[model samples]
Target: MYKLSPFTYTFAGRSKAKKIFLDSTLIFERNDTVAIIGPSGGGKSTFLKILKGIIPEYSSGKLEGEVLFNGHPLSGVYFQENLQKILYLFQNPFSQLIYPGTEEEFLFSMENFNFTREQMDREKEKFEKLFNLKNIWGKKTSELSNGECQKLVLASMLAIGPDVLLLDEPTAFLDPTARKEFYQYLDVIRKDRLLIIVDHHVDEIRPLINKVIFVDHDGHITPGFFTKNNFVVEDISLPKPKTAEEVNVTVSDLSFSYHKDRELLKEANATFKSGEVVAVRGRNGEGKSTFFKLLSGILKPKKGQILLEKNGKTYKNDKIFPHVGFVFQNPEAHFFFDTIEEELKQSFRFLSKEHTVLKDDLLSRFFHDIDLKKSPFLLSEGEKRRLSILMTVFLEKSLILYDEPTFGQDQKSIEEIIVLIRELKKLGLIQVFISHDDYLIEKIADRVLVLEAGRLYEVPRA
Candidate 1:
């Protein structure tokens, strides 16, 4: 059995260090299937770090607690020695990946543990079949989509056969079908191992979890059942599509590929009109994010043209960057400045004082509990995502591309994003986003574009 005695953790350095866990105690037994659920920025990820022996060791923090592994006190040395036994499935899959190729990542732990060739082969084959990773085999980790990356890392962890598995938002990037398959796979293999998952998609994972741990905003963690009233979500209206002929984006005969054998996009053509919110949908590794990057001028297409037109003037390639605002899927990669205040100042520099005040008010709504003086990197994933969105909106660009804008958001935060998108649409900006969230697509997208097998198809709706 693994147990965490009563403990408190305070983030270090700041004059007002934030307390993440206040005298929280939790226990886990073999084969215990537990789900950790809470609002955004409620210390779920932090708690997982503590369990993995990362807090106060790699990260500076004031921690007072006893974490035991099988009745023995867990120390850095002990944790290092037993790395294969206690595995952590990270929230950002890219953060944990070091190898260039997926196959190398799969064999890394096994090689370290000195597994026999036959044993490694057997375990790899089993996990590959379970994860449906044949298509992405031998591919570079950078080439895979976020969902594909998640699957690769997860399959690698399963190959190790850990006694305890810690997953943080394991399905945040996967499509509906892949998400179902992933949970089913977990349910099948969860007999002897202890599974602790931190996710916001409660309904989808409910059947797989026997116990639920709720972490509240007040730094309290306790056993609880799934409840909708845990968050106060405000009702928000969807964006109203507007008519604007002078502002539009057109992609003509576009073709892109990362490798000669693998064709990501081929002769894809589409148009997004001003004030229309478009959602890009596809299976994992289908290059939906690559399409967004092409449109945003972050990547050059191998063939064809992308034209962003506003007021009868056209911008192409690098020229489009000035008018395009992009919220990357990895929110941390989008941040450059140290403090949130410094980051926001970039957006504030161009706006009038009145507009700046309005933007400040919006930021306060989304980040009420945060201190602007703190680093944006210190914010939770959800908080970082929200900050990226607000900064993008403050830019007041002609076109915006959101790559999974609602990735780590909770119900309340998702509703708030809808409100913000609606406001942007009212300003007649052209918005294109890639998301696996059906509800967000249904609520916000004026048109849905499906990318599959290197072709783009438009779904006509009434």
Candidate 2:
């Protein structure tokens, strides 16, 4: 079912008009599975955007790319012409649920894409049996977790039968077990369509990768099957964002509970210090986020107390954010504006106008630091996550608390985030990252704390 002619494309990132390509020029027929790998900020996400048409059109940074379908260019190719032929899975799965309530609407979307009534009837059973969506059949897309919603999106994508499938860091936020299952879906689809992926954990997914396209740190992309030469990323080095130093956060006998329920957290005693990126890890429902709430002043601890030590003053947990920056897991939950500019400007109001110069100085620190006026909410999920982190930095906080930052990011987004955290840490920000990523714990955290039930690991280990 492969079409002839060339499957070529081109694109760029940032305000600079220089074109960059991982596989700068790619010619593939149907059933070709390609993986784009590179260091952080290498434009993996940008490449996917070009393919998704988010680039050059809705995408910013002076786009100069062309994506063709069936030997025909996509310039005037409306989505309706091939709506059933392509589905793009962004890094953040939460924001992709744009349809009405219920899974029925989702199935109806598939029908709109030319899925037959018969295909619709057996779609749930077929998709569920393949990707495990039996329980999600009736659930609202909004209610599903990133992992669950991603699975549903994948199932729906498969049910609709797109000629080309693009997945942007689909498993970057998933746990090890969840990652393995996600790869199975990729393997299933690689056999029949043109599958292009932007990812970093290619070591674990090497077998699924039929070809590898690499984008180095400078946005230079080299494409081909994996070889010793393909792994060369001269600019891919760790950014030392923090220094090993004294503790900045002190949690003494911290206890919290929701209403009258069994204490969700009990006697949590831990101290987050400087010169170290401390990681907090635990199973879900262990009050990990609640602890963050207490530290950020979003929630008050019921029993014990938490204090943030800054410049010799001990501030209460409720007042942490005024001095410390905290980025919530769901940054959208805090957003009321419809545009990125409004969001930033509104948030800046928290600081007085007398500090206006300071505010502009801070906005320059957003990792984007370039063009930030595009549709903020309309940006990809990974991009939104980056903005959230960047906005926290713009606050110029003495301490930063990140909760599940990688929750729904693709590989490129996670890597950029890891770099951003290091840069901010080097600038003397005490960051506390909460996650279950062992690799992140090893790469960024100077100290790793595991929470078993309600207890924090106290012993330091190499």
Candidate whose lDDT is highest = 1
Instruction: Name the lDDT value of residue 218 in candidate 1.
Output: 60
Worst 10 residues of 2 by lDDT: 229-238
lDDT of 1 by residue, 1-462 (tens): 678888888887665667766465678988899998887888889888877777756777878878788876556677676688889987889989989988989889889888999998998888778777898888888888899999888888888788888899999999888899998888987899899999988888888888988888766778879886544555333233354335788899899999898878999999988789999999998999899889999899999889988888999966788888999989887788989989988977766444555775677668647788889988888899999988887787889999999987778788888877877787688989998898899888999999999889998642
Score every model by TM-score: 0.94, 0.67
How large an RMSD does model 1 have?
2.6
Off by over 4 Å in 1: 22-25, 229-246, 352-354, 460-462
Q: Residue by residue across 147-236, what tens digits does model 2's lDDT show? A: 566676767777777788888877655555667777877787677688888765657778877777776655665655654322221222
Would you give me the overall lDDT of model 1? 0.84
Model 2: how far is 71 from its true place, Å?
Answer: 3.6
The TM-score measured for candidate 1 stands at 0.94
lDDT for residue 156 in candidate 1, whole number 0-100: 81
